[model samples]
Target: MTNTKKETRTVNIDIRKDLFGANENAAALNAETFKKHGIVAIDIMGSVGTGKTQLIETLCDHLRDKYRILMLAGDLATTIDADRVASHGVDTVQINTGTACHLDARMVRVALQNVNLADYQVIFIENVGNLICPAGYSLGVDRKLVVVSITEGPYMIRKHPLTIKHADMVIINKIDLVEALEFDIDALEADIREVDAAIPVLRVSSKTGEGIDQLIKVLNL
Candidate 1:
């Protein structure tokens, strides 16, 4: 009798599933860490040139006196956004994602590893500039704010409904240029309402500081 050796096969693993599962686990840990420290972490997500950095700067300027703020800026490269926030007297850490499209929970956890979380009362994570990818990953934040600007054109809200669905609040930024751009502010807001009627939508102009106070009040900061 000839003995035949059993053949071994390598099973194909779904990397995306594994990746998201790992991210969720890490995010839970991050949430626990933030809660223990009494830190309110906000993840700011939006497309490029949506004025995310400026909004953070505006928020920092408004809350710095009342809270110790730490901003984590994520990008493909460079510390430009982090530097901008740092100039506002806010402590910042830049997470250069290289080729990664978004900031994941592991990245945030690793970024804050060296820092003392107890020193900060709030953490604003400016996610990588992309509406699609950032919304898929959770950075273990208390709130996720999506900044959509009139400069991005009318289709932004309709094209990226998932981002809006995932966000706790939708900020219509750069409203100061609404008339100049002939952009329909009410229509854009209506589109957002279509996505998630209950989600809070706020019009803000980080440039002129319009609605900043209202935003602060809404955030309870």
Candidate 2:
């Protein structure tokens, strides 16, 4: 008779807690940073030339009386955007990312030092005009507005689900160009609905100031 020995195997277990809970954690930290200064942070995201900067200009023109406005412009490289937005008579800080595609938590912290968030009720972080990369980063904004212009075509909302998924509001800009480009508003809204059913979508023409009042109301101004 052969004696069989039972073998016991021990698995090593290691527990390492995450310092932050993914994207929301970063967003929360950003929220805290803005709260500390009593500033309302607005993160603007969109595709290139989607009238994003222009939208900010419009917002400033309308909301300037109600809130002190400041801006942080993010680009791959160049102060051109900052310069453009600053022309609106608001303090603007530019973040040249160089190789990076998006503005992260650390970038927001750095930009805060340049401008006094306490002086302004609102601080707008115009994220690198990108639909893809900006979705993954948190800038500590009270609201995230994803702008999709009619010039970019109706398919943008459907194509960039991630951007829509994280957006607190969606602005469909360039409605004035809709007639010229034969853009379909219904289809675009439907596409946005596909990605996010309950998101607030404001159709606006920064060029013509159409639907700007709706935006103002949405912003509570």
Highest TM-score model number? 1
Off by over 4 Å in 2: 1-26
Candidate 1: worst 10 consecutive residues by lDDT? 132-141
RMSD per candidate (Å) reads 1.3, 4.7
TM-scores for all candidates: the values are: 0.96, 0.87
Best by lDDT: 1
TM for candidate 1 is 0.96
Stretches off by above 4 angstroms in model 1 are 2-12
lDDT score for residue 95 of model 2: 89
Clashes of 2: 0
lDDT of 1 by residue, 59-154 (tens): 998899999999999999999999999999999999999999999999999999999998999999999999999988988899999999999999
Per-residue CA lDDT of model 2 for 105-147, tens digit only, reads 7777777766655688888889998889888676678899999
